[model samples]
Target: QENRITTVQCLSGTGSLRVGGEFLARHYHQRTIYLPQPTWGNHPKVFGLAGLSVKTYRYYAPATRGLDFQGLLEDLGSAPLGSVVLLHACAH
Candidate 1:
């Protein structure tokens, strides 16, 4: 069977994250949310307020001005099973 995913459009990025955080906090078994390093300043607060433990995973590589693929893999691989990870994607 294919996995099912849900999507919702919100007024803003902050609002989207807030809504997602709250929904996940209530329905998902995982209580932790892993954000990419160097995420928005208010991310931690928003997720925390939703009762989810906020953590970060390596994402950006300053030296190359690109993704730290290896670091990202290591950090994510070490994360607890069922943890939620928020990844930023470019639409254009």
Candidate 2:
């Protein structure tokens, strides 16, 4: 079986993140949010405005100029369960 996901229409990436972050802040218990390192420039500001404690998890590997799998794992593994995570899945 497969699950369908619902989405919200927004003006842009920043708007979407801000809205989602605000929603989470209003409803969710976990206020701590983890973000991918070297994420979109506006991510921190967006989440911050929503009243979340923003943190970074390893994502970019400066040496390889690619994903840092190990560091990412370490950061994720250390996070408290239920913490919100902002993933940078694509540039588009």
Candidate 3:
């Protein structure tokens, strides 16, 4: 087979997210980051370390083990304008 080239750099998801958040916080003003409920164990810490205030929105439902669509909508509706909402890549 012909040779193929690929690049791989191993970095923790939490670390990457935190770094991104920090950049945003430094560059943006009045920006808020919303994290889903029951998100990654370190999500809150990651964003907080970035100097951004992290808020929570309904995401998971204990009974259904799925997303709470209505709850999410309600939270979004309540969020102030220019807020940054984070959603899981493959929540569905």
Name the TM-score of candidate 3. 0.81
Ranking by TM-score: 2, 1, 3
For model 2, the stretches where C-alpha displacement exceeds 4 angstroms are: 1-7
* Highest lDDT model number: 1
TM value for model 1 = 0.86
Give the TM-scores of the predictions, in the order they appear: 0.86, 0.87, 0.81
Model 1 per-residue lDDT tens digits across residues 2-91: 898967889898998899999999999999999998887899999999999988999999998889999999999999887899987851
Local distance difference test, each candidate: 0.90, 0.87, 0.83
Given candidate 1, what's the lDDT at residue 16? Answer: 87
Question: Which tens-of-lDDT digit does each residue in 1-92 have in candidate 3?
Answer: 78989554437887668767877889987557998887887888888878889899998888998889899999999999888888898784
Residue 26 CA displacement from its true place in model 2, Å: 0.4
Which candidate, 1 or 3, has the higher TM-score?
Answer: 1
Show the lowest summed lDDT stretch of 10 residues, model 1: 83-92
Candidate 3 pairs with clashing backbones? none
In candidate 1, which residue ranges exceed 4 Å CA deviation?
Answer: 1-7
